[model samples]
Every structure is written in structure tokens, then in C-alpha cells.
Target: MEKLKPKLFSVMKNYSKEQFLKDVIAGVIVAIIALPLSIALAIASGVNPERGLYTAIIAGFIISFFGGSRVQIGGPTAAFVIIIYGIVAEFGIDGLIIATIMAGIMMVLLGLFRLGSLIKYIPYTITTGFTAGIAVGIFTGQIKDFMGIEMGAMPAEFVGKISAYSAHISSFNMTTLLIGILALTIMILWPKVNKTIPGSLIAIIATTLIVKFAALNVNTIGSMYGTLSAQFPTFAFPKTNFQMISKLIAPAFTIAILASIESLLSCVVSDGMIGSKHRSNIELVAQGLGNIFSGLFGGIPATGAIARTAANVKNGGRTPIAGMVHALTLLLILLLCMPLAALIPMPALAAILIVVAYNMSGWRECLSLVKKSPKSDLIVFFTTFLMTVFFDLVIAIEAGMVLAALLFMKRMAEVTNVEGWKYIDEDEEDSNDSDSISLKKVPKNTLVYEINGPMFFGAADKFMEIVSDISKDVVIIRMRSVPAMDVSALHSLWNVLRICQKHHIVLIFAHVNEHPMAMLQRSKFDVEVGLENFCPTIDAALERAATIKPYKK
Candidate 1:
């Protein structure tokens, strides 16, 4: 069994001063990159700017300290913006907190059971589709601040938001639009000038200074969310009841699934960069604990931020110490520099999120898949994407998974076949093979049935149909091509056994594969059928059939 140990412990055994210095440099650089983006993500999530800092500080520290990946920077990420906004809008902040805590508990259970690898079963099409949809959601949500549109609180639904934006098209402020454009331009152009300093940070600083000195008439974080909190996060338990838990269950599960996917994906990406392996279950447990603490401290839901994690790696971070230092840096900023964060223009923050959305959209990948992937995959991708954009994200995920499963079952069923062997062709290349059914002579009043492919619920009904036609004095079932069995398929065989008993016919099984044989043994189907009736080959089964006397009805 694999041990549940954090990567930090292993890395610490070989820690050195030179590596510590590099980690510190990388950690501080990542913190600088996370600062403005965290604030932007929180505001986009319809929360105060400080909550982002709180999450980045509290959750970030916990995840790194206990995480399986050396440089996974966990905090408020763009992926959760749509879901978090929806939860906050419908269930209130308390509901969001409760849901996050519930999600945390669920994550811990998933890790403890060592089921983290199960997340890979979620189809890539679905993840790509929803990620693109989330990018769109983030872009749409920022339009109000990005263009300074005069509207009451933004609507939660995509259609409602579109309708409201259209209604308020005439109220967009020119000054705010120009500031947003300026910030966007800076974010786009600054990276070429200085790669070491993030373009988003530079854009924020430039736009905030411009807005402040020029006394521009535009919406700013300070104007909207009021003074930024300069205090450390304080913890408090949320008041909850059964009614709230029941109401929030679906969203909580959604949060857990999303967090698991994003964090593990980030881990996989970072592992490639660092040439290291990550313990997925350990990472999940750390993420759960991080979210639990973040929520208690009045922070929004958080997961691994891919961009920040990448930034850490590119900056020479090679251990968990860097991630921990990154969190501490954010804490120091939260305590001293938070007040300055309020002066940042809303348009600048929107500009930052716009860039984030574009990076995460994966448009090129989506287009390539559309051109080359199978029709079923394309259908799943489009369905998930459209549903996410127009309906609820939870609905999109549920519908996508269900659709994918049904399509998969259909394909499996199509491949599974059951047939009776009439006569083997003498001209066939392998007809003379020793194990060939052609060499065996069937006894009078005997029938041979061959089942091909896996025996699963999807293909069980066809096998049952073959069972219903069993009227021979002696029956032989050939399952050499079968590799596995499900309960439904096993139950169908039981029906065949019952029919043979009622008709007073001799029953035998030939070439029972390992998986099916084990299932038969476990179900005690083998005992009821008699061990002597089970044959290893067609020759043996034919001989056994010939020796057995047919029972009189």
C-alpha cells in the first residue's frame, strides 16, 4: 500500500540554503502574480476583494504544507467564479460557506478511500467544454465593470445577464471603457517589455495610478466594495441546519468535483514541468482541509491555480517550501498592503480576468477536437458547452456525464454478440485449429451457443434472448471470447440454468474465462451447475455432451 505522506516531508530531508534562497525568490514572484488575480477573481465571484486575499493566505498555506505537489499554489481561481457567484446569489454567503465546508468533508472522504484516481474517468471533452464555458462566464460577468455599465446587481442566469446588459447598453460610461481598454492594452503589451514582472500586476499599477492622479470618473474597488480589510483572517463557524444542507448538497458536490478536477489537473501539469510525480490522494486531502479552513475564515471556494503554479515552477521553485513562502508573502500583503488594493480600478481588475478567461478557454484545443474527434465525443463536448453557457453549470456537468455514459453503453452493446454455431467453414484459414469447434462433432439434440465480448448489463438482454430459445436436450455455452461479467449478465445465465432444469436438459459451460469464472464461483452458480459440467475446451464439452443422457420430461 502506498503511504499517505506529503511531498514536503521528503523534500525537507534534502533542504539546503541555496535551494531555500531560490524557493524564496520563486515564492515571492508567485505571490506578486497571485495578488491582483486573486482580487480580480474574488470580485468577479461577487465577493469583497479581501476575501480573495484571505483565501490566498489561509487556504494557500494549508494546501502547500500538506499537498502532494511541491509547487501547487491553491487559492481563489477563475474556474469557480460562475459556480461561486451562483451559490452566493441563490443561497447567500452563509450558504456558500456551508457548501464549501461540505465539499471539503467530501474531498477528505474521497482521499481517505483512495478514490482520487477515479476523477480521470470524467471525460476530457466534458472538462474542456466546461472550462471554455467558464471562461465565457467570467468574460460575461466582467462586462459590467469592464465597460462601466449602469445596472443594478447583475443577474445570475446567463440569459438574464444578456438581457440586462442589452437593456443597459446606453448607460456605459466612456471614461470607464477607456480605462479598461488602457489596462487591457498594458496587460497585452507589457510582457514583451519585462517578462520577470507580470503584465497583470503592471496593468493594475499603471491603471490605478492613472485613475487616481487624473481624478477619473470611473468605478473603483474602493468606491464599490469600500475600504479593504488589513487584518488577518478570523475564523467562525457558519450556522447551519438540515434544511440548508439539503438545499446545498448538489452545489457542494459540484464544488468538490470541480476542485478535485482542477487541483489534480494542475498537479499533473506541474509534475511535468518539475519532472516529478504527485500523490493524487494526498493532494485531494490537502485541498479539502484548505477549503474547510478558508470557509471558516470567510473566504470563497478555492482550488489549484494553474497559472500561479506554473509561475512558481518557472521561477525556480522545486519544493513545498516555495508554496508555503508564497502563502506567507500573501499574508504579509493582506496585513499591510490591502488598503492600497482598494484604489485599483474595477476596469483594471476586469481587464485582468479577461486575460485569464482567454488563457483558460482552450479554444484551439476545442476546435481541433471538433475537427478530428469521434461524433459521440463532439456531441458530448457541444452539449456540455451549450448547457454550461445557457443553463446551470451543475446541470451541464450532470447532463454531460449521463449522456456520455449512455453513449458508451450503446457502443459496448453494439460490439457484444451472441450466436449459435451452425457449421464452421472448411475453407477458413483457422478452421483446422485444434481448439476449433469445426473439429468437434455435436451430439444429437444438442446446441452450442457462443458469446462474444464482455458480459455487461448493456449486452445482457441479448444473452437473455438467446436463453429464452434454449429447447435442446443438451446445451453448451461457449464463453472463451467473454472477458468479464456483470451482475445483470450473471443473472441472465441463472435464467438459462433454470430453463434447462425445467425442460430436463443437460447443461454445460465451455471455456469460461477468468473473470466470468470467478463471478460464477462467487455467486455459487458453479456449484448449482455441477463442477463436472464445466469444460475447458470445445472438444471436452462435446465429449461431455455426448456421454450425458437426456432426462425424460
Candidate 2:
């Protein structure tokens, strides 16, 4: 087992003042980048703006202190916006807290069990689909604030949101729309002028100052959520009941899975940047603890934010210290400067999220898959995407996984085959390959059959159907091409053995692979068929078959 140690311990042995300065600079830069994002993501998740800061200060610190990645920056991310919003709308803030904590526990268990590698088994198409779907959801959710549409309460469902938007289309405020456009323009163009400072931060500052001085009739965070709290969140226990747990369990699992995927993905990106490998299991454990503490402090769920992690790496963040510094910096901002966040125009935050949605959409990858990928992959992609858009993420993942599994089985079944050889003329036999049965003499009243691919449940019936009608005095079964066998295929082989015995025919086996051979030995099928009948090669099987006398009909 890989040691369940945090990366910080390893990096601190050679720590120096020079590197500390670099880490601090990187940390502060990343914190600057995270400030606007955390607030925007929290508001988008249907929570108070301060809760986002709490998540950043609490969860971000916990993840960095104990994480496996040297430069992982954890906090609230756009990926959680749709799911968090849905949870808050359905079950309230307390329920969201419970779900997040439950998810944290689940993640810790996953890491302890060393199941972090299993996350990679989730198909790429499914990930791509849901990411795009989430992007669409985020974009859709931001429309009201972006357009400054006056509506009672936005619906949680996609169709409901669309209906609500259409109903309130006439309430669009021009002043708010202009402020949003100004922010969007800044977000797009500011990066070109200055690469070190984040455009989103500039957009927020500029738009907020303009809105405040110009007295624009636009919605601000202060107008909606009131004065932003500068104090740290007080720890509190969330109220939970058996019924609420039952209702929220699915959502909780969804959050855990999403966190696992996103955090590991961020770690992988950081590893590539710095040429280091992350201990995935321990990283998962840290993420679990982060979310657990975040929820305890009345914060939303969080994970390793990919954009923030990359920014840390690019800005000379080389160790976990950088991540810890980033968290502490956010804490300072939350304490002394949080009140200034009140002046931030809602449209500016919406614009920042719109950019986030666009970046995360992976439209090019989706388009490439549609144009070039296999039909089965395309099906999984479209199914997941459509379901996520029309229904919810949990349903989308369930359907996509089930559909992908069925399609995979179908493909496997197609690959597995049972075939009989056709002997060439004696004059042309010299050209045949060494393994070719034509190179070996086949006795009269004997047949040779070969099984190809894995012998699993998907192809078990086909194996039985092909061998059931055999009328030979002796049968040579070749399985060199078989890599594996399952119980269903073993049962089919047992049936074949029974049929051979009933017909008074001899059976011989040839070239069974390691896995199938082990299964056969375990099942005592080798004993029933006679161990001498199992040969290591086609030639050996033929010799054994030749020694057997033809049974009389």
C-alpha cells in the first residue's frame, strides 16, 4: 500500500526562506483569483455570499493541509452550482449541510478502501456529457441575474426555469443589462491587458464602484442578501431526521462522486504542470475532511478547483504550503474586506459565472465526439447530456451508466465467437500456419472447434448453441484465444460435457488460457472430463483424440 501521507510533510524537509516567499506570492495570487469566484459560485448555488467565503476559508485550508497534491487549491466550484442549488431549494440550507457532510463521510470511506482508482472507470463520454450539461445548467441559471429579469422565485427544474423566464421576459431591466454587458466586456478583455490580475476581480471592482457612484438601478448583493458578514462562520450542527436522510442520500452520493472526480482531475492537472504524482487516495481523504469541516461551519460543498489549482501552479506554487497560504489569505479578506463585496452588482457576478460556464462546457470535445466517436459512445454522451438538461444529474448518470454497460456487453458478445475450422487440401497444407488444425491430422469421426474472446455471460448462450448439435465420436475444444471465463460460460461447458457423455463421445481440451484453466480446475470440470484429455496445444489434443477409439452409435 502507498503510504497515506500528505504531500506537505515530504516537501517541508527541504523548505527554505526563498521558497516560502515564492509560495506566499503564489498563494496570495491564487487567493486573489479565488475571491470573486467563491462568492459567485455560492450565490449561484442559492446560498448567502458569506457561506462561500466560509467554504474557502475552512474547506480550502483543510484540503491543503492534508491533501496529497503539492499544489491543490480547494474551494467551492461551478460544478456544484446546479446540484447545490437543487438541494437548497428542495431541502433548505440545513438539508444542504447534511448532504454535504454525508458526502464527506462517503469520500473518506472511499479513500480508506483504496477505491480512488475506481473513479477512472467512469466512461469519458459520461464525464464529458455531464460537464457540458452542468455548463448549460449554470448558464441557464444565470440568465435572470444577467438579464436583470424581475421574477418571484426561479424554478429548480429546467423546464420550469424556462417557463418562468418566458413569463417574466417583459420585466427585463435595461440598466441592469448594460451593467452586465460592461462586466462581461471587462471579463473578456482585461486578461489581454494584464495577465497577473484576474479579469473577474477587475470586473467586480469596476462594476461595483460604477453601480455605487452612478446610483444605477441594478440589483446588488447588498440589495438582495443584505450586509455581508466579516466574521468567520460559527460552527453549528445541522438538523437531520431519518426521513430527510433518506430523501437526501442520493444527492449526497452525487456530491461525493462529483467531488471525487473534480478533485482528482485537478490533482492530475497539477501533477502534469509540476511533474509530480499525487496520491489519489489520500487526496480523496483530504477532500472528504474539507467538505466535512465546511459543512460544520455552515458552508457549501467544495472540491479542488481546477482553474485555481492551475493558477497556483503557474504562479510559482510548488508545495502544499502555497495552498495553505491561499486559504489563510482568503480568511483575511473575509474578515476585513468582506463588507465591500456588498457593493458588487449581481450582473457582474452573473457575468463571471457565464465565463466559467463557457470555459467548462468543453464544446469542442463534445463536437469531436459527436463527429468522430463510435455510435455507442455518442449514444451515451447524448443520453447523459439530454437527461441532465431535461431532468437532473443523478438520473442522467444512472441512465448513462446503465446504457453504457448494456452497450459494452453487446460489443463484447459480438467479439466472442465459436468457430469450426475448414481444412485445406493436402497439397496446399504446407502454407498453413503451425497452429492451424490443417497442419495436424484429424481422425475420422472427430471434430475440432475453437472458442474466441472472453467466455462470459454475454456469449454463453452462443457457445452452447454452437456446440449443442455436435455429432462427433470425439470433440477437440480449443481455447487458446480465450482470455477469461465466467460462471455462465462454465455452466454452458458443463452442459456440453453432459451432451458428449450422453452421446458416448470423448471430449478433449486444448490451449485453455490461465483464467479459464483456473476456473475449470476449481470447478473440477477437469476431473470430470479426465485430466489427461486437457492438452497444452492443438497438436497434443489431436494426439489424445487420435488415441481414443470411435464410439459406436
Candidate 3:
């Protein structure tokens, strides 16, 4: 299991102080970066900016303290932007709290059950497509803030949101635009001068100073949303209705799935940087704890942030202390700088998101999929992206993934036809485990062909193509390698038998597995082909074919 899993306790206990110091430094830097991001994400998610800080502080701390990765920093991320916004708008913050808490519990349970390793089963294309889609949605949502448009009470639906954006286009404020661009520029240029400090913090502080000293009439967070309270979050309850829970279960599960995917992916990336593997199950449990705390503390959902994790790694974070330090840093800022934070420009936050959107959006990945990926993968990728942008993430992921799977199955089946008799030497696989099976030359008028892999609908065409290529007195198809058969495949086999009858060639199915034989028996195919013609093995089939080779049926 070392190839897939970890002994969670050992990894945690092996931590050293040297790593802790580095982690602390990295954590401090990440905290600075996460500061504006947390508030911005929370605001975008339809809650007060403080809730974002709460997630980064409370949830972030819990995740880092007990999480799987040494350097993973957890909090509200851009990926959950669309979902959290919808939940809050539909059922209010109370509903969001309950859902997050429930999902957390679910995650903990999943880890305890050791299902963490199984999460790798989720397709890569699904993650890539939806991530890109989210990037686009985040990009679009920030347009109002960046352009300083007054989109009052934006709708929850994508179509409605677009209409509202267009309607408010005339109200764009240039001062907000200037603040946003200035912040964006500083964010871009500051890091080159000092890698130790985060560009985002510098940008926020710089923009806040300009607005305050200049007495700009532009809407600040304080001007627009009122001042943030300097109080810590208290415990709260959304609701306990199982009926409501049932409805939210699917969403909660979606959150859990997303959390697993995102956290594990972050862990993988961090591993590349540090050359150390993470305890995935332990990390999952830690994430669960973070989510639970987030819900309890009036915070939004949280997960491992890839960008933040990468930043930590790059900044010399080598242990869990860095993640913990990062959390503490946010807490210190929230307590000390809450009121001062009110003066920050919303447009500046919007600019950060636009940059975030660009970074997160896999537009390049999407283009590559369209131009270079196979037809099935391309279909799955684009379909997932379209669904995510136009519809809810839950729906988009569910439908897009299902469609991709079906297409994959169809393709697999098409390549799995009967190919026993004609020429095994020419089409034989190289000296590998798969290509070990073969057949010698048969009688002049006899045919023998072997079938391979699972026989499903797609294999129907291949099955037909193989048999149609042969013209002999008798045809014997081998089915030794075929492990299972679908109904469509069985029917296709029967039809080929009928074709052999029309061609006046004796048709025989050899060495069909017991499972496939039962299916054929249920469909009464055995009666039509005759019991004697159905050989128990390829050797028996070859003997029967030789006997029937010289004469027409």
C-alpha cells in the first residue's frame, strides 16, 4: 500500500524544528498573500469579508495543525466561489454553515474508512475541465468590481447575472478602475523587488493608503458594506431538518468530492516541490476538521489552496508549522487590522480576482483538448467546461463525467472484436504479457479467430469487421480472452452467426466463458446456433471446423 497510502502518524511525528522555522517563514508570507484573497473570496461568496478571514484563520489553523500535508494552507478558495454564492443566496449563511459542517463530517468518515486512496478514481479530465470553467466564472464575476459597475443585488443564475452586468455597464466608475489597475500593477511588480513579502498585501496596503490620503469618493469596503466588526465568530446552528439535509446531501457530497480532489491535488503538487509524500487520509481528516470549524465559526467552506501551497513551498515552508503560522498570521491581522481593512477599495479586490481567474482558468488546457486530445477526451473536457460555466458545478460535473464514461466504454468495446482465425502472426502483439496468446495455421477451408477483452456495444463494429474479412467453408471464432459480454455484444454475435448461415459456411463459437454462455443461453442463441456447433474449447472448435471444412451446410 506504500505505493498508494501512508502511515499517517509516522509522517507527522518525524517533523523537525529546522523544518518548522522554514515553515513559519513560509506561513507568514502565505498569510500575507491569503489576507486579501480571503476577504475577497468571502465577499464574492455573498458574505462579509470577515467570514473569509475567519475561514483562513479558524479553518486554516485546524487544517494545518492536523492536516496531511506539511505545508498545505486551507481556507476559502476561488473554486468554491460559485457554489457558496448560490447556497448563501438561496438558503442564506445559515444553510451554508450547516452544509459545510455536514460535508466535513462526511469527509472525516471517508478518511476513517480509508477511502482516501480510492479518490484517485476520479477522472483527470473532469477536474481539468471544471477548474477552467470556474476560472471563467470567477473572471466574469469580477468584471463589475474591476470596471466599478453598480450591479446591485446580482442574480444567482449565470444568464441573469449577464443581463444585470450589461444593464449596469453605464455606471462604471473610473476611480475604482484606477485603484484596481494600480493595485494590479503593484501586485505584479512588487514580488520582483522583494520575494520575502507578498505582492498582494503590498498592493492592498498601497491602494488603501491612496484612497485614505486622497479622500477619494470611490466606494470602499466600509463605504459600501459598512465597517467589519472586531468580534470573533460565535457558535451557531443553521437547521437540523433531515428532509432539508436530504436535499442538501447531494450538494454536500459534491463539496466533499471537490474537497477531496482539490486537497489531494494540492498534496501532490507539494510533494513535487519537497520530494516528500503526504498522508492523504490524514489530510482528508484534517480538511474535514477545518470545514467543521468553518461551519461552527460562521465561516464559509475551506480546502487546500494550490496557489497558496505552492507559495509556501517556494518560500521555504517545509513543515506543518508554516501552515499553522500562516493561519496565526491571518488571525493576528483580523484582530489588529479589522477596522483599518474597511478602507480598501472593492475594485482592487476585483483586480486580484481577475488575475486569479486568469491563473485558474485552463483556457490553454481547454484549447489543447480541443485541438490535440482524442475525440472522446475532447468531448468530455469541453462538455464539462460548458456545463460548469452555464450551469451549477454539481450538475456540470455529474453530467459531464457520466457522458465521458459512456463514450469511453463505447470506444473500448469497438476495439474488442473477434479476431481468431485469419492471421495472428501479422496482427499479434509484441512480446508482452498481453500478446502471449496465439494460434497456428488452420486447414485450407477452416477459419479460427480469437476475441479479446470485454465485449460491449462498441466492439460490435469490430466484431463484424473481423468476421466479414474472412471467406471460408467454415468459421470458428475463439472467445478465450474475452472476460465478459454485454447484451448488445451477444446480439451482435448472434447476427454474425446468421451471416455465416447465409454465406453457407458452418459458424461455430469456441471457448466462450461460462458467464457469456449463460447470457447466450438466456437469449436462446444456443438453440439457433445448435448445441453441437458450440464447442467447449478452441481445440474442440478447430476439430469441428476441420470436419465441416470440405462441405457446405
Best by TM-score: 2
After superposition, the stretches of candidate 2 with alpha carbons farther than 4 Å from their true spots are 427-433
Prediction 1 TM-score vs. true = 0.96
* Model 2 residue 462 CA deviation in Å: 1.3
Give the least accurate 10-residue stretch of model 1, judged by summed lDDT.
423-432
Error of 2 at 407 (Å): 0.7
TM-score against truth, every candidate: 0.96, 0.97, 0.83
| Ranked candidates, highest lDDT first | 2, 1, 3
Residue 326 displacement (Å), model 3: 1.6
Residue-wise lDDT of candidate 3 within 88-175, one digit each (tens)?
8877877888889988999999887778888897777888888998888887887787878886888866787889988989998888
Q: Which parts of model 1 have CA positions greater than 4 angstroms off?
A: 429-434, 439-441, 468-471, 550-553
Clashing pairs in 1: none
Of the candidates numbered 1 and 3, which has the greater lDDT value? 1
Candidate scoring better on TM-score of 1 and 2: 2
